[model samples]
Target: MHRSDSRGVFDALVVGRGAIGATAALGLSRCGLRVAVVAPAQPAPSPLDGPGTWDSRVFAMSPASRALLERLRVWDALDAARVAPVYDMRVYPSGREGAPELHFGAYEACVEALAWIVEGSNLSAALGRALSFAGVEDIDARVEAVDCTAPDHAALTLAGGHVLRSRLVVGADGARSPLRTMLGIAATERDYPQQAVVANFETGLPHRDCAWQWFGEHGILALLPLPGERASMVWSAPQELAGELLGHTPEALAERVAQASWHVLGGLRVLTAAQSFPLRLIRVDRTIATRAVLVGDAAHVVHPLSGQGMNLGFGDVAALLDVVARREPFRDLGDALLLRRYERARREAVAAMRLTTDGLQRLFGDHTGLPLPGLLQPLVGARELGWRFVAGSSWLKRRLMAHAVS
Candidate 1:
């Protein structure tokens, strides 16, 4: 529903063209909104030709995320040979002997796969192609200011002083969103004392489509399945340990990784150089204000331990599309009450995920080296008990798996 001419305003203007923002622009366009995406153009990634060239950054895409991409026609466009399905996941607790281990299987869940391990470059390439095919307008500029005071439409002033008007402005910027600041939104932030070190490897033994995770005193280490006899590792290690890891030679790092993972996939050889990113939790008081809305990391960022950060951002795009599509006929896309409806729909899910990821990080992160006295002993025991309880209960596992897939 576009307003009458002369003003040349778009129905929706999306800022940032990362996966989430790009996907939002496509979704908004499909919803029949005259949409445009504003961001500097990026060079397309070079083709992923071999094991040595695999991108170190990969995401564990949930079933919900898969379906959204499928619906948008971006799924089939991906390089199937590069995508890895996670049929099984084995989670091991701290190095205590006989520590309870949890397992999840696709068969138990009655699904094709628990999740799909996709390289960032692969997904981004597909999105870029889809955007081109869909012919969505692209505004290659950085936003300098936003004017949301207008009742009918919001105006975005670019870096060079050009202005673009849109009924609704969607923020898909990263965790440190400049648009969020321009909109005067406050975010509560907490930094984790660790960094996620990522790299890809060729396993000595076939991964058998299984993902492995170990929660040890050092940190959480996840080895997600990759095509062929390969795997991608996300090791959330303490800051000091991460620095040491980064300092090691590729061969030495591979040796360390093999030993830490108990050689579960046998020996490992480096396929990609190691890279590290700091971890943090970012939460906003609200996702909408006036004619504006936030999506992806701009709205929330959770610990990577659960591997649901990207999925949550996809969930935001899905919910926003649904709400705007079903709005009352007379209501504008940026109507205050209409935007609030989208916020209410996503509030609970976002909070629950933040609590779960943050809570687990705290629960397993203690390395105080102090003796637990009296009453504090049971609290220490709860970690083991919790894992055992979840592993032993089929119903609980199903519930947890069901939530994850959705």
Candidate 2:
């Protein structure tokens, strides 16, 4: 462990170094604040490890998120060849009987592109590089304890017995945040009783820069187009069904997935072994307490079906930075009043997203026979509604997009 004297205390201490934490630290540091980020050492061989290892997980970065990365000067650092533009999105119900299709295109909204499909590791590495260049000190240590004794200052103790003080403490740690737990904040959690099986695969046909989602009896399956002849997939299903998929050999799994997807990609070849993560809805009672605040998964965890998880975290960083940059004279950075501004601004946004995602999960995950017909008509209508929604709400969408980059 390394130690440094607290001559001039840092302006902020950000715990967690995932995409959200790193982005928050970089944002604060770029705004002329002295920021220190604490995280464990980088994973061995990196997280992205195989031909299947080329970041099986990918994010559908809304236009707003793209602009935010651009503002942070990090978007340019990502290899253009690796980034795939999502010019259109196609969502439909699965099966021969009740399936209805909905299409959304950037041309309909008069934008360059609706979103970008990016590998998780590529985005993280780009953000890390930006953080390094912005002079944000990355302390290679785990935080053992955090003490918010004083009103204007919060203190942190690392595993190696190093103590560091800062005006504000931001917990972007993740859903099971140590910092949040240390503050005695408990989360309200509900497991969806489903698992998301993610993988990367090569398709016989080119994706043509379109992302697709098929809502089926099992659950929702999303195929996001990637650079080259590849696509990333998130298949959420019941635990038993997920286990069955997991039990298959790679070649066998590829054949099953190809058939399940109705051969949309023609012959499918699995490039990576299937990986699964249990699905859940996690929301903390309070995101702010005294001198500390929470951001990203540390604040909330939404369903990944909509691909809004990371984007929501980016919203947190953007809002917090705005509040901090506009603090009144003589106001402490960690002052309760100053921190409340962030709380109020983010609470409604987070709540709305939680409700929206939860509602979708519940509506789509129900396999009961009663709501089938009623659900089918609306599912058909949703395709038309989605197109109108995206086209008619340009102003609201622009505001949201702007927040991602701001």
The most accurate candidate by TM-score is 1
Tens-digit lDDT track of model 1 for 1-406:
2223344989999999999999999999988889889987778777788646898889999999999999999999999999999999988885766977788888988889999999999999899899888889888989888988887999888877788899999999889999999999999998888899999999999999999988868889999999999999999998889999999999999999998898999999999999999999999988998799999999999999979999999999999999988999999898998898889989988987786677667666545433333323444657777567667878767766776787
Clashing pairs in 1: none
Q: Which lDDT value does model 2 have at 361? A: 60
lDDT of 2 by residue, 231-289 (tens): 88899887888998899888888888777777888888888678998888898989998
Per-prediction TM-score, please? 0.94, 0.88
Tell me model 1's lDDT, rounded to 2 decimals.
Answer: 0.87
Which residue window of length 10 is worst by lDDT in model 1? Answer: 368-377
Best by lDDT: 1
